[model samples]
Target: MQRSFILLCGLLLALPLRAADPDGKFAVDGVGARSCAEFTSVLDKPEGRTAFANWSQGFLTAYNVFTDDTFDITPWQPQELVLAKMAVFCRANPDVVYINGLSALIRSLIPDRVIRDSPLIAVRHSGKSVFLYRSMLARLRGDLNAAGYDAGAPDAPFADGLIRALRAYQEDQGLVVSGLPDGQTLNALYP
Candidate 1:
């Protein structure tokens, strides 16, 4: 299932840019047009979750293709993180369209979008691992420094100092003290 999902993502990346209609509107199909309330109701089922994931992957790929100065709109997030965010948005705004919720999520992520490709680094803690762009690590270091966490030199390797700092920051924010840049940690740091 994971392999197929990865293949689908690769195909999504190659999709051609779509042209807008004469009225400056784009057509939304599939699960995108469903209400947030409907989306929330389906979250517990694997098929429904998979459907939303596929639609979201395609939508984000399209955004990357069409948006200026964007190589990836969500360079730091995993599919699970994105879905979690969507679930939260849908639960809060049950009357809104799912696509609109995705749009709002994208808007919030704009500030962290990767404008260019960068080397990825593996960050692992507590048996969980995530790959993050080096540029994102630099940005994380900067944010931590700004928040008085002192994450060593910006763009430096992820060392003991960085881990300690991350732990401190997470503890201060009442988040899981994972000592790794998890989705919640990144969101809190960036926000």
Candidate 2:
């Protein structure tokens, strides 16, 4: 009985774990299928520019979904920068997986600069100036989330989640744990 149990356990451990959706949720479209050579072939032409712009838009959309709309890096606006980066990566890594090259290019766009001053606190439920309050709060939440702090899900209208995320971020960054969107927290979040 003991030998049979051990064998069964070993077999179960060796078996591959299967997920309900093995392919993942996101589906890559036509442009995503092109090889690095094919993708870089038209970089200097007008058609290439048009195609790259469309492809980059898809990346931006993916970024939004991946970060839950909290990542504010704008790779789509400055098209030239992304195009140049992708071209360079593809050229240097011609034989590399296309997705790996693209991943490097996308990962390079994450912001590195830090905010200088501590901005005013943006309370979610508080009756501060309506527009400025909400916009500031949004930035606070977004930046915190980008810095790897879990600010709850997007579209949540409450303040406690933001406060908890902010507190955790502050602790991680060695800042005062006020749990409010003060300047030091903002600087750390942006940094």
Candidate 3:
């Protein structure tokens, strides 16, 4: 009887500890769900692309609602268009990091401001630890390209094209030409 009792107690204790964190909700960095590694693992498969599409739909909806300042402003872009752009972006940079690409999309669409209600995934830092979202990085690239900043083919990473483009955009906007996407720069670019 004592052995059975001890076994039962042990089992009870172990049960709570066995709980899973597959989506990484308890992650310290808030970037636990669907990691870059996971996204790339299945990137080439049909099911993987489908899963990403589904996730993107949910992500976009959440993002739009999060960034909505008023009921008057429409979402920055349509889901289909954004998805298509992602496909193109993915194809162009086959070796690109998906999380970064996703971040870029978010930045491009919601350049006006970030939502405070929820935390964003895939946060990185510049030299000074300036927090950057992958989507924001992508948005900066696209925006610089659109404004004729000449970032090489509009790829990810803060490369030569992005640097030159940012400088040009800043100069044209007369906003100190810092070549960095600080709050003021984001406001000008998105607005």
Candidate 4:
């Protein structure tokens, strides 16, 4: 069956192929993806049914935020979204992850919880420090503007802020604050 074929390929490949980001740019391996179409179209293959399933699993693994019980991508299921979702998250509200975490902290102190959960912060820290998120976002935004996105261009919606977004995502994911995804982030983002 296709599942077995995927398993066989996984065993033979030696290296696990990472999935592309939302804009179909950053390849699974973090290389500058040349053809967004090619990367996103992997699942379009005749044998893609299995690949799509695996891709969805890996994508959810990377973030650990997607779950059958939690997400309701009914209008847009995760399986249908694996290719485009990451880029959208990274491009738009690149710092929202951190900012939202900061917001949650301030609310918690007032004995008010603005959001129920934030993957951006460890819950222990969430109730106490807002500075971590703010300073991190500010520094990250600076890096993003200096070298990241193109002031929000539509053609290249991903912009240059991705590195910053990725780093912030990495830091929040509890990996080293190297500001570089490396192995951990890749695995986390595409586990």
TM-score of each: 0.83, 0.42, 0.36, 0.21
Ranking by TM-score: 1, 2, 3, 4
Candidate 3: residue pairs that collide: 103-134, 103-135, 104-134, 104-135, 104-138, 151-161
Pick the winner on TM-score between candidates 2 and 4.
2
Q: Per-residue alpha-carbon lDDT of model 2 for 1-191, expressed as tens digits?
A: 99999999999977775433656544456555566776788777888667866777676666654453344444123456556667787787666645556666656555531122223333543443122234446655676678787886654554678778977887888998777665556545542
User: What Cα-based lDDT does every candidate model obtain?
Assistant: 0.89, 0.60, 0.57, 0.37
lDDT by residue (84-170, candidate 4, tens digit) is: 443333344444332233223223222211122322321122133221222223333444445542222322222234444655666
lDDT of 2 at 87: 79
Deviation from native of the Cα of residue 25 in model 3, angstroms: 32
Deviation (Å) of 28 in candidate 2: 2.0
lDDT (0-100) at residue 58 of candidate 2?
A: 74
How big is the RMSD of model 4?
19.8
Q: Write the per-residue lDDT of candidate 1 for residues 1-191, one digit (tens) a residue.
A: 99999999999978875567778798889999999998889888999989999999999998997888999999878888899999999999999999999999999999899999888899887787778999998888888888898899997898777889999999999999999988889888765
